[model samples]
Structure formats: structure tokens, C-alpha cells
Target chain A: MDMAFDALSDASDEALLVLYGNGDPAAARSLTLRMGPLAFRVAMRMLGDRAEAEDLAQEAMLRLWKIAPEWRQGEAKVSTWLYRVVTNLATDRLRRRRGVGLDDAPEVADGAASAVERMIDADRAAALQLALDQLPARQRQAVILRHLEGLANPEIAAAMEIGVEAVESLTARGKRALAALLEGRREELGYGHD
Target chain B: MVMTDEKAKGLALDDFFAAARSDLPEPSGVFLARVLEDAEAVQAGFAAVPTAPPRAGLFARFADLVGGWPALGGMVTATLAGAWIGFVGVDRIDTISGAYFASAETLGTVNLLPDGDLLALAAE
Candidate 1:
């Protein structure tokens, strides 16, 4: 059975999950509406492919559903859990690409984004993505979770399943690597004026 | 922890991080629909029902194991007969199952209850 959305709108994500666990279909819908896009965005940024990211997002949400019945509240935010799951899934996919095309990331459909769209969005965003694609998976995860996702070092540490010190070290190294990669594109990416 | 959280607020000092935040993609409506579909599908399994009744209890299971109440009644009747014979002594057991011993000349059978007296009593 389902509860009214108006009544559940103010409920926290964890509360919605509990309601979903209690067999409320509307709670699942509410959770999907609230957290699905965040999961999709994280997956997209990690995988750089729309379709794959969507699949990963759906997979991660399925995990969320399966865990709802036993979810221990007050442990962590649902977003933090999604960050961990999506990065782990994306990292697995990236690892499989090791021998195949690790050195040469071919242009997928997401890579074929029009220059107008790229311009409409920030050039630095695209440049950062391209540079991020070069770092090893762990470094990319650390950097993305730290910088772009705006997670604190400890939260990134939790998501990456590493020590806080490791997170800091990885983030620092990743930043330096990204800087080196983006150095060549400074003029085009709107950094030359500085 | 408070120090770290405070430090975190000062994050994205880099211009690149700001740009990436601004360029966050809006999830396509189609993808949102697919996610909703997935959620509903998962929840359907959670909420769907066999509508099954409660499981049979031990006595009911034993009753079935013994071939229903009719068989149970037959077993009960045999038990009462055995108890009556045990109270009266093995020599008072019915001759139907006493064939081997009754064949001996030394052992003879007689009715424990007099048929004629019971008939006479009933008629009176």
C-alpha cells in the first residue's frame, strides 16, 4: 500500500526508506524522486557515459532498496552510501578497461557532446573531466568526491574506504596531476588571462 | 570534527571546482522514469502477497499424519479395548486374536461378559 506524497514529503530519506521497508510503495517513489538524480550525476561524472551511468544508478538504487529492510539509521547519510556504491561500481568498470583501452579513452556518445553545449556549460568543467579521466581510479574518486562533490575529507574517506590521511594524500596528488594535465589547456579553458 | 567541518566550508577555493559544480547535468526525464520503474518493480516484490493462511499446528499436523480423524477414532477404539483387556487380564482378551493359544487343550477361552445376561437385561 502507499502513503500520500504530501504527508511523506517532509520525511527524511532514512525515514522514507524505513517506510518503504514497511511495504509502502509511495515511499519508494518518493525516495526515487529525491535521490535518483544525485546517484545518476555521480555515476555520470565517474563513468562519463550516460547509459552506463543510468544503469549504475539503477543498480545502486536497487542496492538501496534491498538494504532498506535492514538499514541501520544514524550510521550515515544515504548520499554518502550512494557515493561509495557508485564509485565502487564505476571503479570496477574502469578496472575492466585496464588492458583494453586504459591509455586511450575512445570517444563515447557522452564524449561526442556538441561544442555549443560544452561552451554553454563551462569549458573548465569539460577540461576538468578530461583531466580527471586520466588519473587512476582511486585518485579520480578521491578528487571527485573531495572537490566536485564537495564532500569533506572524512566523508570522502568513508566513501573511498580509506583512512583520512590517505584521502588527503590522494586528493593532493590528484590535484597536482590535474593541474599538470590542465596546464596545457589554460588559454582555451579560460585560465590564460590569470 | 568541528575544525574539519569549518575547513570544509572553505572548500572549492579552486575556480575549476566551481565550474564543475555549475555544470552539473540535469537528469533526463526518461532516465528519471526508468529509475521510478525500477523502484516500483522492487517494491512490488516487497508488497506482493501469497495471501497464505497460517501454518498448521503440531496437533493438526499429527492428525493429518495419522490419516485424519476417522483413522484417529479407530486408533482410539483399539486403545480403549486394549486398556479394558489390560484391566481385566490377558486371558480375558477376545478369541479373535487368541487363535494360537486357544488351539491348546490346556488353555480355553470364555466370554468375559455374559452375552445371555446382557441380552436378558436389555430386553427387560
Candidate 2:
């Protein structure tokens, strides 16, 4: 097991995907560890539901597993590819929601934080997620990928399958919309106290 | 007061965004297991290694060559076997008899049978 971990540590995601295609269980485990949370968080933030996010994460990972054999080395980062999958899947679900929004609060695990800090973080994340859900799907995706996921415009563009200019436009508009939605809720969100 | 309040609001928003991103949610063990299961299911169906049985017949070998569909491979093997038995098998029989004819004169010269007797046996 340690040897498998060692073999996986230095390997690139593409190489790990190749290993996975060849039925290396360690590669799948490594990919799940490395990419699962990212997919989960993106889906959770985008959809504002834990169960749906988990489903999307599973679907995206399943697609990755299916495509591993044909995955082109160095053509794309595995994370980026999963991001694209999650984005598309989340977007499809959003469309199917038809504006009947599901306002389920996101599930956040606060490891090592105090009770008060966890409450504060959870409240703030809930507020941000509410604001995020109010934005258009494309704009919401762009903002989540940019601000929360910390992805660059080009990567966001690739994930969303849009032009870089479109990514910038969507993110700018989305942030402005978020600010508008979140502006007066400072006190309610515990931001005024801070 | 308004300018100060605006600056505070901006700072608060920044803080909010920061706090929102600070801690990501950990996927539950069940969720991770499901993802792993998905990977397992997909990997099972994927041909990680070529499926060639070394001692398999021509059709099975061909099927393995073309990506290991046993039914299709079996059909191909049957077709090749039929062609070989029907055409090449007859040709081989004719060649064996032709060799017998080519050596007949030398063998018959030993008078194992009289000329007319040999002719009658050859006709038979």
C-alpha cells in the first residue's frame, strides 16, 4: 500500500489515469482523494444541495473512469476535465430545475475549528450560496469557479466551454449580482460584527 | 460616516468571500465509496489488457486480435475452418494420389503383378 502511494505520489494525473485504465486500484483511490472534494464543492455550491452534488460527483468520476483508456496524455489536466464534467452536469440539473430553486443549505465540514467559528463559517457559506443560486447558471458557474475554486479565467473558460472574455464578463456580472444580493444581509450574516 | 461605512461594507464582503472559501466540505465515506464503486464498474468493463488466449483456435485468436468478442471470433473461426476443410482438404487428397501415380511405374516394374493384372488393379 505504501509502495502504491509512493508510485502514485510523483505521477501526473494523466499518468495516474493511464494506470487506472490499466486497472490500477491505487490510481482510482488517488484520483478520488485528490479530485472528489473539488467536484463535490463545485457541485454543492452550484446546486446548493449535498445529495445532488454527490450524485454529480459520482457521475463525473464515472465519466472519468470510463474515459481513462482514451484519455490523451497532457492534452488536459484531469482536474480540469472533471471540472468540465461537473460544470456541465450541474448546469444541466440547473436547467431542469426550471427556476424552482432548491434552497437546501450546503453541507460544510469544519475540521479543527471551534464551535463558534464553525457556526460563523456555516452561516457565511450559506449566505454566499444563497446569493450564488440567485445568479444565472452560467454566471453562477463562472463565479464559483473563479472565486471559490480559484481557477483562472482560461481554465474557467475551458470548464464552461466559453471564451475567456465571456468568462470575465460572467464573473464580473456574477460578483456584482452577489454583492447586490448579499449587501444588506451583513448583520444577519454576522459580517457587521466582524 | 457614509464613506467609512462603504469601506467597511467592502471589507466585510471580502471577509465573507474569504470565509466562504476557507473550509471546503469533506465528502462522506459513503459518497467516496460510491465514486470508487463507479470506478470499479467502469474498470471492469474496460479492456485494460488485450484478451488473447494463446492456445485458442484461429477464430478465438482473431476475436482476441480484434478486441475479444468470443461469439464473433467463433463465427470467424468456423468460416475459416469450413473453407479449409471443403477446398484445401480435397486438394491435399488429390496431391497424395498424384504422388502415388508419379511413383507407380517404378513400383510396378518389379512384377508384383502381371501387366494385365496391374492394369485391372489400377482400373479398380
Candidate 3:
């Protein structure tokens, strides 16, 4: 089983998916290790709750495992599909927990910082999150993929299941909104001239 | 022209992004492990459930036979079934209506004239 996991670790995402489809347990573990952190991080940023992020990540991985049998080769990157699932799940959670803002979310376990640094980081994260929250769900997802995840426009388009032009429009509008929201507070967020 | 303006906006946005990226704290190792463990548990749950092999039942097999012959076999079968049921229903209704109409006609108490003629006569 260890050797199987090692082999699966070396396999491409598509190969792992095929193995997963064959009900290989090691392949499932390898795929989870490969995608778990990414899904968790994206969920954390999108949902702003570590516990919920963990739940969403687990749910997304379970969904991927369940759908492995139906996966087609050369359709889309497994990571992109996972991101889309995590994004949609986080969006659903956000909608369900309406009127609950990120500030109200419990802080991460190791989130302690010096007073000054805490203030700065908190202000920045809060401003950025607020701007993100104001965006339409799809636009927020587009911005997160394009800007935060550093995905290319084409990849974002694929992850979003949208046209390239639509991705471009979403990111453009999202960035504009973010900039407008964060403009005057750049210095307070420690983003001013060095 | 607009090129310079776009470049300046890009630069400003990049700086803002760099700061934002730097401010994001790394997730704790414990948190990361917990996430992985949760994912593994979920995968295990799915693994525990054995998936049944795909098989067609008796009714489905019959459907396949009647549905497979030609391009329109399935459609023809469906259409014929629908038409047959409809014919049977209409036949029943016609029989009932005919019996009632005959009874009324024989009694000479029923006039089958058009409503327009009745209305014209009433007006007169």
C-alpha cells in the first residue's frame, strides 16, 4: 500500500483519477494530499472561517472521489475542477450564513501578532475581504482565481466554466471595485510608498 | 495615450497585491494536518460503500428489445402505446355519449338545434 501510494504520488492528476476510478485507496490518498491544502486555503480565504474551510475542503475532496469514475481525460485540470467545487461550496455557505460577516468569525488558532502588526494585518484583510464580499459571487471567484491564485485568464475561464471574455470582464470589474474600496486606506493597510 | 494610464493602474494594483499577499498568515501545521485527515476520512467513507455493477432489469431488457430495432422503433412503440390508450378512452366515451344521446332522442324531449338558432328564435 505504501508503494502504491508512492507510485500514485508520482502519477499525473489524470492518472490518479483513473486509479481512483478503479477504487484504489492509495490513489485516493495521493489525490487528497495533492489537492487538500489548495482546497483548504481557497475555502479559508473565501469563507473566512477555518473550521468551515476544513469542512468545505473535505466535502470537495469527497465529491471529487465520488465523481472520479465519470472523469474524462483532457477535459479540465483536476485542480481547477476542485477549485470550482470549493468556490461554489464556500459561496453556498456564505449565502446560508447571511448577515454573518468575517469579523464575526473566530480567529485562527495561531493568529497572534504584535499590537501594531495585528492592527495592520486585520485592517488590510478586513478591507480586502469587504471589497471581495461586495462583489457578485462569480466576480469574487474570478478575482480570487486570477489575482490571489495567480491563475491565467484562460485557466480562470476554464475553472469558472465561462468564456475568456467573460472572465476578463469579471476580473476587470472586480479589480476596479476592489481598488475603489481600498484606495484611501492604502497607507493604513501598510501598502503605501516604501 | 491610454497605454500609460493602464500601465500605471497595473503597477498600483500590483503593489497593493504584493502587500496583501505578504500580510496573509500561513495556515498552522495543525490546521493543515486536520484538513488532510478530514479529507482522508471522507475518502475512506466513500471507499467503504461498494458500488454495484451496472445491469439492466427485466423491464429494461424488454424495453431494449422493443426500443432497439430501427431508428424509430422506440418512438413508434411509444406512439402506438399512447394512441392505443387514447383510442380506447375515446371509444368508451363515445359509447357512453351515444347511449345517452339515443335515449334522449327517442324520448323526443331533446332538441339538437344550434345555440344560434335558439337564440334567434328567442329574440323573435
Candidate 4:
């Protein structure tokens, strides 16, 4: 009965996933609600477009639902698996772009290329997102997972299918690039003194 | 002086990262609905691995009513035994019990009873 599924807010994601595999619909609803935002946020960070981000999030969640039945307990965390899925999907989308790649894409933030054209200065987050979008796919993935998602280096490594040193290297490079891109916007973005 | 400048640069970037974190894009209601729909669709195709068998049918219910197969077996054995007892004549049974007890006057066997009242007591 649906009524029997109450008090399930505290259940871990893996526990809920196992329940979903066992044909419990409540578990599905709860899991989707919990993990959907994470997928969307990461996808948005990796890919600047909202439409594509939503699609990737939905696709990642679909994969999660499909893998429910065979989800091995204590083998891996649900969030980590989800991070891997989102990053891989975003990477595929990045690769499929027409005439766009690490070397080919513009290095500067869109519209913030020169001192004459400052970032709109209304939204710091938007300014940061624009800078992040200019980064390579791997660096973006590492930065989003490490800084935005607050994941550890090892966990980011596991998610990105890379070594811990690679994760560190990507984040360091990503931060340096971000700093350079946003350096011209210090006064306009409201961080004049800092 | 250069280290100080680098520290300020790091601090500025940290502020931007914090803004991005706080300004996370919310998943639209439509997006949530679509995902839930997808989740339901995916779950629907799953082969339900029931740990136990399906619901009980009439015969199974009856078996349960009779306290399961062992109880039913015992009841059948008892019914057959009663039928057999009814089919046998009393005289034949008396012969067997009387021979065993040595209480039959015609058997000429040694009398083994204080009183010839075993079957009567058993019946009582």
C-alpha cells in the first residue's frame, strides 16, 4: 500500500534504489526527487544550456532507474555513480558539437573578451558560468565536481574515471583559467577590495 | 607581494564559486514531472522478483483451513482406519483381542485377565 511507504525520507539512496528494483513505486518517486536536482545542477554546470542539461539529467536518471535491479549493495555510492553518468553524458555532448573543441573554442568568457566589453555585472554566478563554459570538458568536470559539488579528489577521480593527480591538475588549471577570465570584472562584479 | 596578489586572486575566485553554488539552477516542474514519468515507465518494465509465490487459490485456502498437508494426510489416514474398523466384524476383532488377552473361553488359552472387561473399558 502507498500508505506503508511513509517515513522513508531518511532512507539512503541505495536502500531506496533496492526498494525500487523490488517494484516499489514510492521508492522511485523519492529517489527521483532526491537525485534529479543533483543531476540537473551538474549538467547545467558542465553544459551552459538549460535545455540540454535537463535532457542529460533525465537521461542519467533513466539509467539509474534501469540499473536499480542489479544495484550491488556496498559496492559504490549512488551519488558517485550519478556523478559519473552526468559527467560522461556531458562529455559526449561536448564532443558532438560542430566546429567546437578545446583548441577551437574561444578562450575568453563570452562578451568579456576585452576590457571594453565587461561582464554584464548583474550576476556573479552568470559571469562565473560563462568563464567555466570556456574551459575544456575535463577541467570543467573536475572543477564542478570538486568545487561546486564539494566532492573529494578521490571521489571526483572515481566519477571522472581519472587518477587523483589528474583531478588535482584539472582543478588547479581550471581555477587558474577562471581567475584569469574573471580578473577584469573585479570592480564590476562587486569584489573590488577582495 | 606576489604571494599576496595570488592569495587575493584565489579569494576572488572562491567568491565566484560560492555565488555559482548558491545560484544553482532549479529543476523546472516540467523537468521533474518528465523524470518521474520516465522513472515510472522504467520501473513498469522491471520483472517483479517476488520472494514468495502468488496469492492462494481455493484449493490452497482449503488446505490451509485443514492445517496444511500433514494435517490433511492424518485426517485421511484416520478416515480410512475408521472405515476399515467398520468393515471388520466384531466377532473377528474379538477373536484377535481375545486370543492376545487369552480371555476367550473357546480358545482354551490361559486366562490372562483379572476380569474380562478390557474392550468394555476401552469403549468406555
Candidate 5:
């Protein structure tokens, strides 16, 4: 077990993708384990709904598996490609479901919690989520990729398929928009009091 | 005053986003397991299909040439010679056509007067 873990840990993303392309079942699992969190987080950040984010992440991973055989080497990192796919999927979902309220979507709890605590956390999360939901899709993606994911401008550009200057502009605009949306509710949302 | 106000607001917003990050939900282990299972099923589906193997290499093609290196070289040389001969033959045809035209002009100049007397009398 330790040996297998070590082997997986040592393998490059490209090598793992090649293995997956060659129809190795374990490689798919390993890839999902490695990329799932990032994909889910990006999707959630972009879509602001846990259920939708989960769906988008799974769909992106499924597409990744289906496309492994056609993946060309040195084009982009597997993780970057996955990010682009999830981002585009989430964007499409948002466009399709435009003008829908978050209240209508089912809420997901982090884990088992007391009724009161769950409500409090959910409300706070929901409020922040609303603010994120209000951002333009491109700005939201840019913010998630740059600030949350900590990608460099060039990397974000590559993932977003834009120029570096465009990335900088998008991130700056996204930050301004997010700040404006969250500013009024800061005290209500329990931020910056300390 | 504006710069200071903007800076403070920016810092406050950053702090707020930091707190928001903590409350973001995580995917449950069950969900993770299901995703992995789905991935496995996909891999299995792909495995059910067979793919063709890669084609032979350039070296293999070269080795398969029936005649040896000398024969191949001779074949290439013969092809080039045939092409050159065809090109030169076109030029030769053009030259023959030009000569034929010149001979036709010379024939047109031929005056076969039975005797120069009738032609001189007609001229007079």
C-alpha cells in the first residue's frame, strides 16, 4: 500500500494522464483524488451552489476521462485543462439559469451539526454566495482563479484563454466588484469587526 | 483622504473574504467516493473497446524495399532522367515546329513561272 502510494506520488501529472489514456483504472481514481478538490472549489466559487458545483466537477472529470486519449502533450497541464473545462461548464449553467434565486436551490451542510449552528453557517455562507453570484461570470472566474486559487496572471490567462493584460484587468475589476458587493454587508456578515 | 479611505476599505474587504473562505463547504467523503466510482465505470467502458496499434516506422519501410540500396538509387536516378528527357523533348518539338513554319514561308516565296518570259511580259 505504501509502495503504491509512493509510486502515485512520484508520477507526474502527464504520466498519470498517459496511464489513464492507456485505460488504467487506478490512474483515473488517482487523478480525481488529486484534481477533485480544485475543480469543486473553482466550480463552487464560480457557481455559488454546492449541488451545482458538485455536478459540474463530476461532469468535468468525466469529460477529462473521455478526452484522455485525445490529449496532446505539452499543450497544458492536466489540472489547468480541468479548470478550464469546469469553469466553462459552470459558466454555461449560470447562463442557462440566469435570474434564478439562490433560495430556491437546496443547501448543503459541511457536516453533521446542531440545528442552530447549521442555520447560522448556512445563512452566512448563503449571503456571501449571493454576493459572489452577483459578479459577472468572467470577473467571478478571474477572481476565483487569481485570488482563491493563487494562480499567476500568466497561468490565469492560459486557463482563461486570454492575454496577460486581460487577466490583470479582469482580476482588478473582479476585486473591485466583489469589494463593492461585500462592503455593505460586512458588519452583518461578521467581517472586519475585529 | 481618498487614498486612505480606499486602502482601509480594501483591507476590510480582504478580511471579509478571508472569513468567507472558512465557511465555504467541502465535498463529503461519500460524494468523493461516488465520483471515484463513476470514474472507474468510465474507464471500464473505455476498456471494453479495442484500439488499433501504431503504424510501422520509417526504418521498417526502408527495409521492406524489395531491391537493395543500389537498386533504390538506380530507380531514383532513372525517374529523374525520364523527367528530364520529357522536358527536353518538349523543347525539341517547339524547335521542329518553328523550322517547319520557316520552311512553309520559303515555299510561299517559290514562283514556278514556266519561263521567266511570261512573268516579265505580265509585269510589263
Candidate 6:
């Protein structure tokens, strides 16, 4: 079973899509394992709400499922396609919630850390998320994709449907804005002792 | 104490990002299950869509019904020819059959009594 899962994960996304189109549960499981967390994390970082993020993730996966049968081979990587979908969905929510502001930052965990340390870390993360919320939607998306999600600039460009130069500009300006937003709050968030 | 240098600020921002990365939340079980459920639902929908079987043309069915292309053509030709014979050829053949089988005058009727040689038949 381990080997089967390993093999499934190793299969190309297109191959998995074909399997999924044929109603293979293993394919669906593999796809969820491979892309689900990424989608959720992206949505969470973009929207800063777990429930909304989960919804967006499920929506994106549902779209993927819908397109599986008509999914052309070698057209787009599954990750890229899913990232674009999540980004669009998150951007829509962001537009809808514009001026309504972000909800409270979610509780994040730091394994093997002392309780006090974990609290500080969570605060820092929350502070970052709040600051991310302040940026323009595109800038926030580009920044998160580049820094937190670790997608390369080109991949980020594809995900955002923008040029590499534009992605660079967005990330640069976003980082500067974040730095400005987060400058004085570092000590309050418990980062100075680090 | 707030360290106020560009480089120091950059380091602090990097630290925040590191913390964010480290503390990022994974999808819960319920969320994963929801995604898989959606997948199953969509796939089931796709399965439910009825696909029409490939249609065989009349000639193709006929070909299969007979034996091969040549035989199929031959069978069609034979049927048409038989129909033509029944409709047109039968009338001409009927005239020939009537002429060939027409009754001729009987050669001659044989006399049952011999002339003058017949004795007076006594009534019995």
C-alpha cells in the first residue's frame, strides 16, 4: 500500500487526472494529498480565514474534477491550474469583503516549542497575516506565492497570469509595504527577543 | 528595544516570515474529506452522462449480416434481379408457356363399330 501510494504520488498530474476521470479513488486521494494543502495554504494566506480557505480549496478541487474528462494532456500543470483557480476565488472573496476587513488571525502551531515560544510565534504569524491583508490583492498574492508558498517567480507569473517582471514588481512593492506595516509591531508580536 | 536600521528591519521581517512558514496550518481531516467527496461527486456526474454507441450504417450492418463486402453487394444485386424477373420477365415467359403447351386437334376419333361387319346385336 505504501508502494502504491508512493507510485501514485510519483505519477504525473495528467495521468492522475485520467485516472480520476475514470473514477479511481486512489487518483482522487493522490491528487488531494498532493494539491489540497497547497490550495488551502494559499487560500488561507490570501484570505486569512480557515473556513473560507477550505471552501475555496474545495471549489478549486471541484473545478479540477469537472475538467478532468476534458483535460487536455500537457496543457497546464495541475498545480499551476489549481493555483490560478484558488487565486481567482480568493481575489473574488477579497473583493466582496473589501472594507469589511479581515477576521481574527487563526491559531497556528509550532511543534516542539515551549508554550510561551509557541504563543510568540503565533503572534508573529498573525501579525504577518494581518499585514498581508493590508496589501493590494495582487501584491499579496504575488508575495505569498513567492515567499511563503515558495513558488518560483515564473511559476508565480503563470499562476497570477502576469509577466515575470510584473511578478517581481508586485513582490518587491509588497515586501516594502509589509516591512512598513510590520516595522513597529515586532516587539509587541514578541519578535525582538529572537 | 527597537532596532531601527534597514538591514535590521529586513532581518526582523525575514524572521517573521520564517515563523509564519513554520506555523502554517495544514488542512484538517474534514477539509480533505470534503475535497475527496467533491471529486467523487463530479466523477459520478461524468459517469452518469450517457455516451451513444457507435452507429453502424445500413450498408455496414448489411455487410455484417451477410458475410463480406463482395457478398453483401452480390446479395443485393441478386434480390434486385429477382424482383425485376418477377415484375417484367414473368409476363413474357407466360406467352411462351401458353404457346408450347396449347392443345392440338385429336389425331382422329376411332369408330367403335365396324362398317357392315357388325352382326345385329341381340338385345341381352
Winning candidate number (lDDT): 4
For all the candidates, what are their Cα RMSDs to the real structure?
10.2, 10.4, 16.6, 10.4, 13.2, 13.2
The better-scoring model by TM-score among 1 and 3 is 1
Residue-wise C-alpha lDDT for candidate 3, range B1-124, written one tens digit per residue: 5675455556666665555566563555665566556545655665677779788887667667766446357677789977876777755655566697764333223457878999999999
Per-residue lDDT over A10-105 for candidate 5, one digit per residue giving the tens place of the 0 to 100 score:
788888988888877667777877877777888888887778889889888888877888889988998889878999898898888876764554
Give lDDT for model 3: 0.71
Chain A: TM-score in each candidate? 0.86, 0.86, 0.79, 0.86, 0.82, 0.84
Q: Extract clashing residue pairs from model 6.
A: none
Q: Estimate each model's TM-score.
A: 0.68, 0.70, 0.60, 0.70, 0.67, 0.73
**A30-124: candidate 3 lDDT, tens digit per residue:** 77677777887788778766777777887887788767778898988999999889999988877887776546544323332233244454555
Per prediction, fnat is 0.66, 0.66, 0.22, 0.83, 0.40, 0.84
Q: What is the TM-score of chain B alone in each candidate?
A: 0.43, 0.36, 0.30, 0.42, 0.37, 0.48
Task: State the iRMSD of every prediction, in order shown.
Answer: 3.5, 1.6, 3.8, 1.8, 2.8, 1.4
**Each candidate: what lDDT?**
0.78, 0.78, 0.71, 0.84, 0.74, 0.81
Quality of candidate 1's docking, in CAPRI categories?
acceptable
Global Cα lDDT for candidate 1: 0.78
Docking class of 2: acceptable
Name the top TM-score candidate.
6
DockQ of 2: 0.44
lDDT tens digits by residue: candidate 4, A1-194 = 35645666889999999998888889888887899999999999988889999999999999999998889999889999999999999999987874665466443344443443344333678888878888878998999999989999999999988899999999999998888878876776666663
Candidate 3, which segments miss by more than 4 Å at Cα? A1-5, A97-127, A191-194, B1-10, B19-124
Superposed model 6: Cα runs more than 4 Å off: A1-6, A101-120, A190-194, B1-4, B55-59, B63-124
Clash pairs detected, candidate 4? none
Backbone N/Cα/C clashes per model: 0, 0, 0, 0, 0, 0
Error of model 1, residue A145, in angstroms: 1.3
| TM match of model 4 to true structure | 0.70
- Clashing residue pairs found in predicted model 5: none
Q: Over the stretch A1-194, how does candidate 6's per-residue lDDT look in tens digits? A: 56667879779988999998987878888988888898999999998889989988889888898999998888778888988999999999888877664354332344312444445666778778888987889999998988888889999999999999999999999998889887766555555544
